[model samples]
Target: MDGVILNVVTWSDMYYLDTWGRRQFMILGAVVMSICMLIVGMLSRTEGRPAYDPTLYKVNFDFANIVSAGTAVLALRYLYVASFAIS
Candidate 1:
């Protein structure tokens, strides 16, 4: 690597880097990924969706179910965070 300072390297680095910043990134990424999955999952129901055809996006799942599950998991994580913050 060059002499330039990189932001982060390992998971432990995340621990000392910025707790809130890492949490925010994780939360945001999860949300965006979940949304994208939901959209693609819905499109799968239709015969043809231009953005992702069978040849492109090849994931199989019930969109609503996945969204519900993802939300629940993330929410639980955030709940723990909230609990910690309150205490």
Candidate 2:
């Protein structure tokens, strides 16, 4: 059972890295940004006092940047694998 699970996970990870990993990361970033924007907008719309902080935007941007960088690294690794396989 453990072996089977490990095999499945390995296959899934390979497939994701080769195919959809970068796209998925991009989608995740967009979703995170959208959610952050929505939260800030809602907070700003609240009565009297402003609840949104600039730090929140900075934090969200930093998180997305990290994800993008990681995704880029993975994509480069995938390209290297492809090149090695072709050679």
Candidate 3:
């Protein structure tokens, strides 16, 4: 996902830079990446959380905080890579 996003962004980034300029893209990427990373970081600080209910619960991502957090982190990671690559 990281590689793919990076590669895809790289191809179009030149156009974006040409059209919008690097300063704006850099700032946009920086802001997006910072927000993403901050969310992921906050999520990481919370560990050992139960994903299921105390009753009639099964181990699953659907009921777990990790599901959202993990997804957020994965998304953030991709954004981070893309932003880094773009700049």
Candidate 4:
């Protein structure tokens, strides 16, 4: 997903770059990517819980929460990659 997003954005960036201008595009991309990074970091942090379960050898969390968080993190990462590619 990340690779696909990055490739698509990189390929189409010329159109957006021309419309937004270099400085605006860079600033917008940086801000969006930075926000995504912050949210991803918060969601993936292991400070409160060891993300990996020692006994089960998998993520140590409720199945639904883990699935949702993983999805969110993946999406955010993809967004960050696309943003950087465009910038």
Candidate 5:
């Protein structure tokens, strides 16, 4: 799921840079997204209480962690692209 989001954002940034030639916004968006992902990862890592009806809930895979990982990769790629664009 997070992979999908990062892919979309990356494509969007590339598209914006190609069409509008706005590398500033592209870099800005990528950095903001990276920070948001880091925050999400930190929050997810912390222990949390179960839902009110604990019995109704079940354990599942950590999608947030997966997303954060994907976002980190995307952030690196974005930085690379931004560097080329700015230079």
Candidate 6:
């Protein structure tokens, strides 16, 4: 979930940078990311789980799967770009 959100934000930032400029994209990305972090932090804290207990927290397999998939896609993208650039 977080990874998906981050990917969306990243793509949105790229679009903004292309359409508006670097300054606007930087500001927008910073603000959006900060808000997301804050929301996640608050939600985690409100779950009432002890900090020392790993088992108390619910495991989000969906989030993990999405993150892994996103990572693989990004890695492939980088490899393609690098290969093309080298040629």
| RMSD (Å) of each candidate, 1 decimal | 12.6, 14.6, 7.8, 4.5, 10.9, 11.6
Report every candidate's CA lDDT: 0.45, 0.45, 0.72, 0.78, 0.53, 0.46
Worst 10 residues of 1 by lDDT: 1-10
Tens-digit lDDT track of model 3 for 18-56: 887878888887887788778766666664253665586
The C-alpha TM-scores of every prediction are: 0.34, 0.32, 0.67, 0.72, 0.34, 0.42
Pull out the clashing pairs in model 2.
none
Candidate 6 — what's its lDDT? 0.46
**lDDT order of candidates, top first:** 4, 3, 5, 6, 1, 2
**Top-scoring candidate (lDDT):** 4
Candidate 3 global TM-score: 0.67
**Deviation in angstroms for 75 in model 6?**
21
Q: Judging by TM-score against the true structure, name the best candidate.
A: 4
lDDT of 5 by residue, 2-78 (tens): 45554665665675576676757657666765665565455445522223446867643244436665455446555
Worst 10 residues of 4 by lDDT: 44-53
| Clashes, model 6 | 0
Better of 2 and 6 by lDDT: 6
Model 6 agreement with the true structure over 1-35: per-residue lDDT tens digits: 44554465566555545567666555654565455
- Error at 46, model 5, angstroms: 0.9
- lDDT for position 65 in model 4: 43
lDDT of 2: 0.45
User: In candidate 6, which residue ranges exceed 4 Å CA deviation?
Assistant: 1-16, 51-87
lDDT of 4 by residue, 1-87 (tens): 777888889889988778768998798899999999898778767322446778988875332546778778778888899889978
lDDT value, residue 38 of candidate 5: 62
Model 1: lDDT to the true structure: 0.45
Give the residue spans of candidate 3 off by over 4 A.
Answer: 47-65
